[model samples]
Target chain A: MNVFLQELRSQRRSTLIWSLSLAAFGSLYLLLFGAIRNDISAFEDVLKNFPPVAQAALGFVIGTLKTVSGFYAFAFTYIVLCGAIQAANLGVGAIGREIGGSTADFLLTKPRARWSILAQKALAVLVLLVATNVVLLAVTIPVAAAQGPDFDAGLFVLLSATMFFVQVIFASLGLLYGVAAKKVKSVVAVSLPGVFAFYIVGLLGAVVGEDAIRYFTPFKYFDIGYILKNAAYETGFCLVAVAVVVVAVGASFAVFAKKDVQAL
Target chain B: MNVFWRELRANRKSLIWWCVGMVLMIYAGMAKYAAYATSGTSIADLMKQMPASLSAALGFAGLDVMKASGFYGMLYLYLLLMVAIHAALLGANILAKEERDHTSEFLMVKPASRSRIVTAKLAAAFVNVTVLNLVSLGLSFAVVEQYAAGENMTDEILLLMGAMFIVQLVFLFLGSAIAAVGKRPRSAASLATTVMLVTYVVSIVVDINKNLGFLRYLTPFKYFAAAPVLDRMGYEPVFVVLSALIIVASVVVTYLAYDRRDLKL
Candidate 1:
């Protein structure tokens, strides 16, 4: 645990940068939301005019754009993209740097089990992700409140909580890529394509009106819009997100444990 | 030359993966076409039913909505923008990775002149992009011929492909030159990526908002309009000339910078 804490301390700068960036994206969305707050009816008119297929493709559901949560769902993809990039950058560098610098073997020689080292590094990444999401929530909540009392606080809280789990799933994806790829550059290749594929699947489903394909995209499970409307997540997607974390993290540990290392 | 060849060969898997990915998108596109074709509605009719706003978002103005070539124009531009960026970055980074790997000293110590070494590396990067583009084009045509047969083809489709191919070459060569001059490979990669991304954003913003039109001319991406290219009017000679000048200037700058610089890694 001390080693895990130490790793977190070592990553303080990266953590701060990611946290600030996530907050910035959240703040940008909120600012835009505020700009349009006075003219909700005009916005509704725009949404109403969209073709159903196009609306679905863009996740611009009718009658939802006026609510804070609705706006959140509308802008969720951009925020998630930013968050996912943060997690991917962390995963690519965290382990690969140790290997690149020839410090992995030296670290392994310490009074630590391989599992402990892996666990601690993973914990550091998780903490960073959580901290970023927390900062995002911290800023977004007050902004939502300032908008109106009718804002669904319960749904807002639930959506924010889901972001934590969402980040973990994506971070684990990055870690898995880190473990499997031989070079750090390959980590970005894996994460970017993987995220894009999921997004594309979600889009395909939305455009084709096929709920079945939605199951393939993590975005569908999170359903920022649904959570905002119902104050809860899709139960099945929550389970899938948890399952993804368990499988990816377990697989990453298994791979990292056996990989060859050289000491500086 | 040997080192360049080595890096190019090492990237074979990546090249193959990229080719397959693009071909798969084309397949998906053909599927979209098939769905429309089977509905007994002519391509023009189906397209006419699409909402004006949606068509605007999808970049359909001045494009034939009913033809295979038109669909290709609408979809291929976005896909190729992304693919070409990937290819350019890959081409640039692989050329500089030897230094990043601390193997540049071994490679650079050969009896060949520094200019020859740099030229070989740049040549290899060019060849990589050229081959990838050719493969993607070949696969796209194959799919168009086999699946979307008897469709009205346009000169615009050819021009679109040609413009994208040239754009890929410019970006790849420009990025390679930037990489060669930079002291750190990671910095080089970041710089190249940032430049390309900023250019794309500028180009898009300019197109979407008429107020930003004046800023468009500054970005290399704005040189070839998707509408014009898809219309098969051929590239504006001015843009082609500008791209060539930029490519030549970048190459010269790289050669000058690298000739005097020392490799530390």
Candidate 2:
């Protein structure tokens, strides 16, 4: 319990920074919606000329750019990309930082068991991610509601909720990378490329229109277009996402429990 | 001179990994292009459905996707991203590693002046960027020759590679400047990556909205927009000069600060 509080306190500043940054990002995109709302047709005309594959690659849907919700969905793609990086940073750095900073020995010398320490740290990270999402939603929901009275609050909430799911998926993967790698020299070095590779894969899947490839990238798991039209996530993909997190986190605990802590 | 050799030796493993990663990325893109190329006009028709602004935003607005040069032009965005990250990491890590790894005391006690150390480190980083660019150039040419449907696009390919080299130089100095200016440098690589990402987002925003056009001046990514480079086979002279000034300024700042700043160790 003390370990969990310590981890949370230590990560508080970064969590606040990331949450504020993401909120600012969301607000900026929502503000832009006001500027272009009146001239949406002009924006549509611009989008209409884009090739189908290019449009898919960009996560833009035609005929939908006119509405505040649709435009927000389009801008949300960038938000998710940034959000993934933040989560990955937190996840990778959670365990990796102690080892990388040569402080693992100090932590390990404590009376607590390794599993307890890992659990506390992982729980702290989870709490931070949840806090970030709460702040994001609290800020974005009112701003989105201000766009129009007709705004589908429920659907908007649903769409924004997907960010948390995606973050969990990346966070678990980052945890795996943190434990599995021989040594993590720099968190960003590992996380940036890892996130971008998945992002590019998502883009490629869009361009190729391959349903199977969509399964590979977390960014595609939500399918905003389908969510907007159907008002729900694909159950199959959600199940896969859950399975991934469980396997990755379970493996991390097992490996970390048995692995010898390297002396710096 | 010793510092230069040591930096190169230390960086060799990472350099190889980066080179291999680039090769795999290019190979993957080319392999995808081969399928598109062999599919005839159907793929082009599908591409034509993309909006003009979307195409422009992607930096491949008006090119023939079937042509090897055009395809390479499209893939240039990803390549630019990889190279920029490489350059920034190199610049940030070269100087900052001494402090981060707690080895500055040993190096600082050496006979060489701080300026000499900076020059040697910078030289090593420059060499790494140059070598990586060359490898990319060689591999790109090889791929085009093997898969191209028309005449060799040697000039077009070379021009794009040159532009990427300039981009690398710009980011390299910027990274060095960030490291130099830090009071207690921790995670210089992450700081550099944040700068790169913020600028990239700014560039994309500028592309999406005409009202935000002035934001283009803020990001290095905008300075070398791929479409103009692919279509005109040249960069805007203004941006080129601006990039040079940025490089020169960063280099000057790095020297002055690094010389005066106290080592954390």
Candidate 1 runs further than 4 Å off: A1-75, A134-166, A180-190, A193-220, A223-231, B33-70, B145-151, B198-210, B214-225, B236-242
lDDT top scorer: 2
Name the 10 consecutive residues with the lowest summed lDDT in model 1 chain B: B49-58
If scored against the real structure, what TM-score would every candidate get?
0.78, 0.86
Name the runs in model 2 displaced over 4 angstroms.
A33-60, A64-67, A148-150, A201-212, B30-71, B144-152
Place model 1 in a CAPRI quality band.
incorrect
At residue B117, what lDDT does model 2 achieve?
99
The DockQ scores of all candidates, in the order shown, are 0.17, 0.24
lDDT (Cα, tens digit) per residue for candidate 2, span A1-264: 988999899889878988988887787777666655555445455545656654454334444555567777877888898899999998898888887777889999999998898888889889999999999999988998898777888888899999999999999999888887877777887888788778767656424656977888899999988998888999999999999999999999999898777987
Q: What would the per-residue lDDT of candidate 1 be over residues B131-235, giving only the tens digit for each residue?
A: 767776776677676545676454555666677777786777677777777777755665575567557656644543445578866777777767666555777
lDDT (CA) per prediction: 0.66, 0.82
Residue clash pairs of candidate 1: B156-B232
